[model samples]
Target: MKKKSIVSMLVAFYLAFGVLFSSVSAKIQSEQAFDNKIVKRLKVNNIYNHIEALSKEPRVAGTEAEWKAVQYIKRQFDSYGYESELQPFTFIEYKAPTKVSVNVNGDTVAAAPFTYTPNGDVNGELDYIGLGTPDDIKGKDLTNKIALIKRGEITFGEKVINAANAGAKAVIIFNHLSGELNGTLGNVDNRFVPTIAMTKEQGDILVEKLNSGDVLSASITIAGSVIEEKTSHNVIAKKDVTHKQKDTNQVIVIGAHYDFVPTSPGANDDASGTAVTLELARVLAKVPTDTEIHFITFGAEELGLIGSNKYVDSLTDVEIDRIVGMFQLDMVGSKDAGELVMFTVDGEKNLVTDLSAAAGVRTGTPLTYGQEGRSDHVPFYYAGIPAALFIHSPTEPWYHTPEDSLDKISKEKLLETAKIVGSAAYQIARPDTPALERAKVAPKEVDYEKMTGGLK
Candidate 1:
C-alpha cells in the first residue's frame, strides 16, 4: 500500500476504537444510576431513633459501653438480614486525670492535669524554668525539682516532654494569659512526667518568690492517668444480590465511627453518623445491586482513626482495589452544625463525592467538597479507593463535649444528609441496567468556589 493510504487506514481504525469506547462507557454509567426507589426509604425518624438509642450513654473506645454500642450496631445490621461481623484491634488507650493538686509551702493551689501525662505524686523543691523549651533546660539542673514552666510559643505536649527530658521530677505549666490551662499531650507518651496546669497569677507569684532567693518546697499529685492495652472493633455488614455467583467483584463501603470522646454522648459527633449508616443499610439491603455494599461502624476514631485504619489494613491488595467507593458519615445531624460538606484527603473529587454531589443537587441539598484528613474516609482514600467524608461543618459548640446530646440533634439535618448520601450511594451501588437510567442521575460540574476550605 502507498504511505498515504496506510496513514488514512490507521486514522480510520483510531476513530472506530474511540467511538466503541465511548458507547460502552455511556452504557455502564446508565446502568450504575440504578433505581431511585431507595432514596425515599431513608427516613429521618428511623435515623433519629438509632441515634437516640446509641447515644443514650457515652461510647468511649474500649469501654464496656462502647462494646455494647458495637453489639447494638451489629444486631441492627443482622436485623436487615445482612451478614455482619465484629472486627477487633488493640491500641494503647490513654485517659486524663480525674484529680490534680498542687501544694506550695502548705497552701493549696488550683491545678488541672494534662491528658496522657503520667500519674505522679512528688515532693521537691520548686525551680522556675522559663518557657520549658529545650534551651531553657539545656544547662540548668531541673533534676529532683518541680519545674515551673510558662505556656506559649509551643504546644503543652512539647512543654511536658521537654521537662521530662530534662530530668524534672514533675512539670507545672501555667497559662500564658489569665485562665486555668487545659491541654493535652495529643497522644499517650511514656516519657511524660506528672504534668499539671495552673493560672498565670499563681505562676507569677512563684516566679517572684524564686527571684527573691526564696527556696520553695512544693508537692504535686495527679490521679487517674491510665495507660493500658484495650481492644476496639469495627462492625461490618454486607448486602448483595441473592445470587452470589453472578455478583461483581466491585464493592461499595459506607462507614461511620461509633465511638465518642470521654464523657460525651456523641449524639452529633458520631452517633449521628452511625445512625445514618444503619438507616442506609436498612434501606439498601433489599435493593437489587450487582455490587456488594458493606456497612461498617468503626471504633477508636477519636484515638486517631484506629478502627478504619485496621479495617483497611486487613484487606488484601485485590480487595482494596475492588472497592469501588467509600462514603464516610460523620457529624451529619447537628442542629447547630453548618450545611453538608464533603471532604477528600487530597482535595479532589472521586466517585463518592461526585455521585453524592449529583444526588444532592437532584433531591435534598447541594453537596460541596474540600480537603480534610480527620475521618474514617482517610483510610480508604489512602488505600487508593474513591472515598469522601459526609459531614456538617463549622461544627456545633457542643462538639467533643458532654453537651453533644440528643437535644442538639436536628431531624431536618439528619434527613437532609441522609437523603443526599443515600441517593448518592444508591446511584453507584445500584445494579447497572439500561432500564434503571434516569435524567436526574447525571453528574454535574461541582461549584468549586462554593466549596468549603477554599478547595485546597
Candidate 2:
C-alpha cells in the first residue's frame, strides 16, 4: 500500500509540471504576438518622421515654433484615432530685453538679457560686487555702477534683483568656471535689471584687470517684458477609461516632454520619447485592458516641469493614490546609448523599476536599474506614487543640441524600447485569462563585466 501511494504522488507531480509548462508557453505566445504588432507600428510610420520634423524647428515654450509643434502633436493623436486637447494654464513668462551689450574701457562686448530683467539703459563705473547680494552692495558707492557679480551664492535672478534695487545702473554676473553660463530670471516677475551672466573664465579675466585700478566702464540696454495673459496647454489621451477596480482612480501614466530648449530641434531630447508614447497609445487603445493608461505629452517640461506639476496637483488624494505608476520616457532613440536604466530620486528602488526589470526578463531584453528621477516622474513620486524615468544611461553627445536631429535617431533602439515597454505595460494592463502575476524571483542584478563582453 505504501509503494502504490508513492507512485501515485510522483505521477501527479509530473502531470502538474507538464500542464504548467504548457500554460506558460501558451501565454508567452500571446505576448509575443502583441510585441510583433507594437514593433511594426513603431517603424514604417510617421512617428520617426514626426520626430524629425519637430526637431527641425525649435519648440521652445511660448514661441511660435512651440505652437506649431503643438498643432503637429494634435494632428498625430487625430491620426491615431484618439481624442486630444491643448489644456492651457497660466505661467510667468520671463522675457529677455531686446539687446544687452557691455562696454569695458570703450571696447564693446556681446551680452544677452537675464530673463525678466527690468527695463533700463545706463552707463556707470564698474564695481565688482562679490556675488552681488544686497549686503555686499550696502555701503559701496554702487549707485550707478555695473556690479560684476560672481555666479555662486544665490539664484542668478536674486543677484540681478538685488543689484537693481540697490541702485546699480547695470549688472554683469560672470560664470565662476570655464563654460558660458546660460542664465534666466526663471519666470515672469516685475523685479529685474539689465543684467547678463558670463563664463567664469570671462568674469575672472575682467575682474583681474579691473582690480589693478584700471577705471572700467560699462553700459547696458534693458528691454524687460511680460505676457500679461499667456497660457500653454498639455495634451492627454486616455485608454481603458472604465477600469474594473474603480475604488480609487488608479492610473498608470506614460509621458515625455514635448518642448525643447532654444536653437536645438530637441529630437532625441524628447521627440523620441514623445513619438514612442504616441505609438503605445495607438496599439494599446485597440487592445482590451483593465488599468487606465494616460498617454500624455507635456509642454514646458524644459520650463521647470510645469506641465507635469500641474497634472499631479490637480489630482485629488483619492486620484493621486490611484496613480499606481508613472513612467517618463525621455531621450530614448539615440545610438551608442548605455544600458537602459530606471532611475529614482535617492537611488531607491520603486515599483516601476522592479516591474520593468521583470518584464525584460520575460521578453529577453536586458535593463539596468538605478534611482535617479529628474523628469516628469519626480512630482508623482513626491506624491507617494511609484515613478521612474526610462532612459538609456550616458545619453548620446547630441542630446539637447541641434545635432539631435532625425539622422541621430536609432531605429533599432526605438523598436526595442517600444517592445519592452509595450510588453511590460500589457502584462500589467491586459493579462491573460489567469492574469499575469509578478515573477516570484527577485530581479537578477545587472552584471556589467559580462555585459561589456570583456575587461577594458
Candidate 3:
C-alpha cells in the first residue's frame, strides 16, 4: 500500500509540471486574433478598384504598358508603408506577329502566328505531314516545301523543329478539330522557321487538293516577329518582423504574376492576383508578428515564368531554405472560372495546403488541392520550399484573349481568395505561444479531406 501511494503521487506531480511548462512556453492570444484584424481590413471594393485600374490595358512583358503596370504596383506597395523595389532581368522578348496569312493558289486564308516564329516570306509547294512527329518527318523529302501539320500527338515546337531539319521553308499547323489553332514554338530557338496556324477546315481542303494531284503552291508571310533582349521587372515588398528578439528567420512569400499575354488585359489571368497581393500587403503592414512576409509581383509569366524563375535562381541555398511557405495567386477572381483549388508542383500536399485547407474551413469556402506546375509557384516548389498556387481551375473562356477584361473579375471571388490566403499566412506567422489557448493564432482543425481529397 505504501509503495503504490508513492508512485501515484510522483505521477501526479509530473503531470502538473508538464502542464505548467507547456503553459509558460506557448504564446498568448487575445479573444480576437491577428488574422481577424487582417480580414476586417480587407475590403472587396479596394481590390476591385485596383483591378479596374490595372486591367485597363494589355501589360505584356517589356512593353510600355508593362512598365507602367510595374510602376503602379510599386507605388501601391510604397503607399502601404512597405519598402518596394523593382528587380529587372533580361530575356529574349518575342513580338507577336502583326500580320500573318497563307495563300494557296491565290486563295487567301486567315492564319495565326505561333510564338517565337521568325518573320519571313516563303513560297513553296505545300505538303501534308500528319501530326508532324519525328516518324512522320523521316524519309520524306520536304526540301523547300511548306509542311502542313496537324495539332495533336506532339507539341508545335517538335513539329517546327522536325520540319526545319527536313529543309522545310515554313510550317503550318492546323487544329485537329474545329476553329483556329493558337500555339507556340515552345521557346526561342535559332532553328525556328516561319510557323503559323490555321483552321482544320482550311488544312483539309489543302490536303485534298494535294492528294488529287492538283499542282499546289502556297505563300506564307509572318510580319513583326522581333527577337531582342528586353528588361522585365519584379516588384517586391517586405513586412518586417514585429518582434526582433522573438523573430523566426523563416519567411513567407506571397507572389503573383503581373504580366499578361500579348493583347490581353488579363483582368482574371492576373490583375486579380496582383490586386490581392497589394491588398494583403496593405492589411498586414500594421499587424504585429514574429515572422516576415514578402509580397512580390513577377513579370514575364506568360513568357514561360521567366520572372519567377529568375527570382528563385537569385536566392542562395541558405536563403532558399529560410522560406517556410509560398502562396501564389493567379486567375483567382473570375466568376466564370472553376472553384478555387490549391496546386503543388509535385501534386502533393505540404504545409501550404494544410494551412489553406484549415483557413478555407474557417472562411466557409473550403478549397481542394491538386497537382500543377504552370505558374510562379513552380520555381519555389522546385527549390524544395513549400509552395502552392491559388487559382481557379477550368479557367474562364476569356483566358489569354482580348476578352479577358475587368467585367470578368468577381469581387466576391477576390475577397474569398484573399481571406483564405491571409488567414493561412497568419497561421504560420503568428507568435508562437506555449499553448493553443494563449497562441496569437486561432487554432483551426485541419480538414484532411479538403486538403488531400483522401489521396495517398
Candidate 4:
C-alpha cells in the first residue's frame, strides 16, 4: 500500500508540470501569432514612400507646406478605409525682426530679438537688475531705463513683464551659457517690453561696467517684427472595436508630429514618426480588435505642442477616461542615432512602456526607458494617460537642420520601431486578451535600465 501511494504521487507531479509547460507554450504562441499579423503586413517601402513624399519640403506649422502635408495624411488614412477628420486650431505666429541692433556706450553689441517682441526703438540708461524678478526691482527706480538681466530663475517673458511693470522701457537678457541666446517670449503679451537676448560674455561685460559705476546709455532698435493669427490642423483616423459585443471600452492613441522647423526637411525629426503612424493605420485597418485606436498626426508641434494640447483639451471627461495608453513616435528612423529608448514625462514605468518593453523582448531587443518631455507624449501624460515617446537616443548629427532629409532615414530602424509599437498596441486591442484595468493588470515585470540624463 505504501509503494502504490508513492507511485500515485509521482504521476500527479508529472501531470501538473506538463500542464504548466503547455500553458506557457500556448501563451508564447499566441503572442507570436498576433505579432506576425502586424509584422507580415508592415511594408517598409510604404513607410519610406510616405516619408519621401512628406519630407520633400519643410512643413512649417501654419504654412502652406503644412496644410499640404495635413491633406496628404488625411487622404492616406481615407485610403485605408478609416474615416479621417481634420481638426484645426489657431495660433499666434511670430515673424522675427528684419533688423535688431543694440548700441551700448557708443559700441555695437550683438543682440537677437525674442519671438513676439514688438517693434521698438528706445534709448535709455541701462540698469543692472538681478534676474529681473519683481523682488529684484522692488525698491529700485527703473523708470524709462533699460533693464539688464541674466537668463535664469524665470522665463524670458516673465522677466520682461516684471521689468515692464516696474517702469522699465526695454529689457536685455543674457544667457548663462557661452552661446548666442535664441529664445521666445512664449506668446504675445501687452505687458512685454522690447526684449533682446545676448551672449553670456557680452552680458557679463555690461554687468561689470554697471557695477563699477559706469553709466551705460544703450539704444535698442527692433524693426519689422510681426505677429499674426494662423491656423494649423491635426489629422485623426479612428478604428473602432471590431466586435462591439466584446468591447473593452478602452482607447489607444498612436501619434506623431507632422510639422517641422523652417530649416529642416524633417524626414527624421518627425516625418519618420508620421510615416510610421500612417503605415500602422494602413496595416491595422482590417485587423480584428476589441478596443478603439486613434492614429493622429498633430500640427504646430514645432511650436510648443499646440496641436496635441488642443486635442487633449477637446476630449470630454468620458473620452479622457476611456483612453488607456498613448504611444508617441518622434525620430525613429535616423541612421546616425543610437539604440532605441523610450521616454515618459515623469520618467516612471506605465502601461505604454510596460507593454512595449515586453514586445521589445519578443521582437529580439529589450528597450531602455528614460525621462524626457520634449515630444507630443507630454500632453497625454499630463492628462493622466499612460504615454511614452519612442526615439533613438544620441540623436543624429542633423537634428533640426536642413541635413535632416529623407536620405538620412534608416529602414531598419523604422521597421524595428513599427513592430514594437504595433505589437504592443495590438496587445491591448486584441480581443483574445483580457480587458486591462489599470489597477488590476499587473504586467510581467522585466528588468530594464533607467536613463536619467536628457535625450542627447
Candidate 5:
C-alpha cells in the first residue's frame, strides 16, 4: 500500500478497535455473584444505630470520648472474629476551658477557643490590630494588651505567631463571615498565646465600640489549651480468613475517620464509613480473597488528618508499594447529599478510582468521577499508591453542625454504595478467577449513537 493509504488504514483500525471495545465492555459482568448471605450481614441501619450510639458525644483526639469510641470499635471487631490492634501515637491535645467569653467594655460576648491555642486568661485594652501581621505590627504597642485580629491575609497560626512575637497578651482572631467560629490554628505545636476565634458579629461588636472610642477594656479567656505528648490511636481489624489476591505480597486497605467535631455528631461525616467498613469485614471474613484486606477506623481525622498521617508514616516504602489500593469512605450515608463521587489527589487516574468507578458502572449505579483528596486517601496517594475517598458531597446542612445525628443516615445509599464497592472488590479478589492485571485503562466515555450504528 502507498504511504498515505497506510496512514489512513492505521487511523481506521484504531477507531474500529475503540468502537468494538466500547460496545463489548458494557456487557461485561462486574462480578460472578455476591454472596448476599455475607452482604446481608452488613445491615446499613445497624451501622447507623452504631453511629447513633457512638456519636452521642464528640470523639476529639486524646479525650475520654475518643477513648470510648475506640473501645466501641474494638468491641465490634472482637465480635466479628477478627484480630484487632490499636496503634497508639501522641499528638498535641488542646483542652479548652468549659466556657470562653469576651468582655468588651465590660459586656460579656460569646466566643470559642481557636483550635490548638494555649490556655490562659488576660484582661487588657482591646487593640484592633487589623489582621495582625509581622509587618503591620511594627511600632505597635501590644505588650500587655489584647490584639483583636481579623481572619485573612494569612493563616490563623501566622497571625497568632505574629501577635505573640509582638508581645500581645492574648490573640482574638474573628471569623471573616458572620457566624460562630470553629476550626484549627494549624498543626504546628509552637503557639504561645491563649488565642480564641469568634464569629465576625462578635468581633465586630468589640470593633464597633472601639471605633466609637468606647473604653474597650476587654477580658479574653480561652478555656482551651495545648498539651504535649497527648496520645491517639488507630483501630485495625483483620478478617477471619486471609484475602485472596493475584499478588501474594499485596493488600487492599479500606478505612474511615471516626472522630467528630465538638458540636457535630458526624454520623455521615464518617460513622457511616466506619460502620460500612466493619460490616464488610464481617461479610468478607468468610468469603476469602487472595490479597489481604485490612479494615481500619481512624481517630483525630478532624485534627488535620493527624491520625492518618501517623498511620501512613508508620509504614515503609516497601509496605506502601505493597498496598495495591486504599479506599477511604467519608460521609457515605447521606441521601440528601449528591450522587457518589470518587476523589483522587491531582485528579489523575489511579487504581482505587479504576476499581470503584468500574464497579459502580457495572453495579448499575454509576458514580460521577472527579478529583479530590481531602480525606484519609491523601496519605496513600502521596505514597504513590492508588487511593480514593468515597463520599457523598454538598453534605447536609447538619454537616459540622450539632444536627448530624443517626437519623440522617440513608440505608439505600449505603447499601448501593456497599454493593457496588463490595462487588467491585470481589471481582478482583474472587479466588475463582485468576487475578486480572489492574488494567490501567481510562473508562471509555459512552457513545450510544456510534455504538448502535447511529440509531436514534
Candidate 6:
C-alpha cells in the first residue's frame, strides 16, 4: 500500500511541472514571433543610406540646407506610402554682430558679443559690480555706466538685466574661467542692454583698476546684430490602427530632430535617429496594430527644442490624453560612445522605459536607464506624457562637432537601436497587448544608473 501511494504522488507532480514548462515556452515563442516581424524587416543598409544622404552637409536651422533636409525627409516618408505632412512654424533667428569693439582707458579689450545683443554704441564710466546680482548693485547709481560683472551665480542675461534696470547703458560679463565666454541671453528681451563677454584675465585687470579708485571710461560698439523671424518645419507621418475592431484608443510617438548645429554634419547627433525613425515607419507600415503611431522628425532642436515644443503645444487636450508613450532617438549610432541607455527627465521608470527595457532584454542586449533632459523628449514629458530619450551615454567626442560625420556611424548600433525601439513601440501597438496604463504592467526590472556624461 505504501509503494502504490508514493508512485501516484510522483506522477501527479510530474504532470504539473510539464504543464508549467509548456506554458512558459509558449509565452517566449509568442514574443519572439512578434519581435521577428520588426527585426526581420529592418534593413541596416536602408538606415545607413538614409544617414549618408542626410549628413552630407550641415543642416542648420532656418537655412536652405535645413529646408532641403526637410523636403528630403518628407519625400522619403511619401515613398514609404505614408501621407507625410510638413508642418511649418516660425522662430526668431539671431544674427551675430559683424563689428564688435570694446575700448577702455584708450586700450582695446578683446571681446565677443552675446547672441541677441542689440546693436549699440555708448561710452560710460566703468563701474565694478560683483556678479551683477541685484543685491551687488543695490542703492548704487550706474546711470550711463558700463557694469563690469563677473560670470558666476547667475546667467549673463540676468546680470545684464539687473544692470539695465539700474539705468546702466551697457554690460560687460567676464568669464570666471580662462576660455572665451560664448554665451547667449537665451531669447530676445526688451530690457536687455548691449552685452559683451570677455576672458577672466581681462576682467581681473578692470576690477583691480576700479578697486584702486582709478576713474575709467569705456566704449562699447556692436553693429549688424539682427533678430529676424525664420521658418522651419516638422515632418509628420501617422500610422492609424490596423485593426479598428480592436482599437485601444492609445497612441505612441517616435520622434527625432533632423536639424543639426551650424557646423556639424550630425550623422550621429541625430541623423542616425532620423534614419532609424524612417526605417521603423517603413517596417511597421503594414504591420497589424490596434494603436496609432506618429513618426516625426523635428527641426530647430539644436535651437532649444523649439520644433518639438511647437509640435506638442499644437496638440489638443484630447490628443494629449491619448498619448501613452514617446520614444525620442538621438545620437544612437556613435561608434565611439559608451553603451546604450535610456534617459528620462525625472529619473524614474515609466511606461516607455519599461517597454524598451524589456525589448532590449529580448533582443539580447539588456538596457539601463538614466536621468537626462536636453532632447526632443522633454516637451512630451512636460505635456504629461511618458517620454524617454534613447541614446548612447558618455557621448562620442565628436558630438556637435564637425567630426560628427558619416565615418563615425556604426551600422550595428543603428540596427540594435531600431530593433529595440521598433519592438517596444510595436509591443504597445500590437493587437495582443492590452491598453497601456501608466505603470500598470510592471516590466521585468532592469539595471538603472545615472548618466555618465553629457553630449559635448
- Clash number by candidate, in order: 2, 9, 9, 0, 11, 0
State the weakest 10-residue window (summed lDDT) of model 5.
447-456
* Every model's TM-score: 0.71, 0.72, 0.70, 0.85, 0.69, 0.85
Candidate 1 per-residue C-alpha lDDT over 1-456 given as tens digits, one digit per residue, 9 for 90 to 100: 699999999999999989877775554344234425766676788899999999888998999999999889989999989879989999987767787888999999888888778888999999898998888878987788898999888888888788877778898888879877788878777777888888899899999999999999999988887789999999999886544554555678899999998888999989999999999899888777766788999999998999999999999887886787788999999999898999999999876786677667666477788999899998888888888998998789999899999999999998888777777667555554211111122234434322211222
TM-score of 6: 0.85
Whole-model lDDT values for every prediction: 0.82, 0.73, 0.85, 0.90, 0.75, 0.90
Model 2, poorest ten-residue lDDT window? 433-442
Writing each residue's lDDT as its tens digit, candidate 5 over 18-74 gives 988766554352232343434455567666677777878877778888899899998
Tell me the spans in candidate 3 whose CA falls farther than 4 Å from its real position: 1-32, 92-114, 121-183, 195-224, 261-265, 334-339, 392-411, 433-456
Task: Give residue 67's lDDT in candidate 6 (0 to 100).
Answer: 93
- Alpha carbon lDDT at 426, candidate 1: 70
lDDT of 4 at 64: 97
Q: Give lDDT: candidate 5, residue 247.
A: 41
Residue-by-residue lDDT tens digits, candidate 4, 1-456 = 999999999999999999877876666566777889998999999999999999999999999999999999999999999989999999998889999999998999989999999999999999999898888989888899999999999899999998998899999999998999999998999898899999999999999988999999999999999889999999999998998998888889999999999978999989999999999999988799988999999999999999999999999878888888999999999999999999999999988897888778777767999999999999889888899999999899999999999888999999999999999898888887766665223233322221100111
Off by over 4 Å in 5: 1-27, 34-49, 52-58, 95-230, 239-247, 432-456
Candidate 4: which stretches are off by over 4 Å? 1-22, 139-141, 174-182, 198-216, 439-456
True lDDT of residue 192, candidate 4: 89
What stretches of model 2 exceed 4 Å from their correct place? 1-58, 63-65, 75-81, 90-100, 103-115, 125-131, 134-151, 174-182, 197-218, 221-231, 242-248, 261-267, 335-339, 371-374, 401-408, 431-456
Against the hidden true structure, what lDDT does model 5 obtain?
Answer: 0.75
Error of 3 at 216 (Å): 9.3
lDDT of 6 at 293: 94
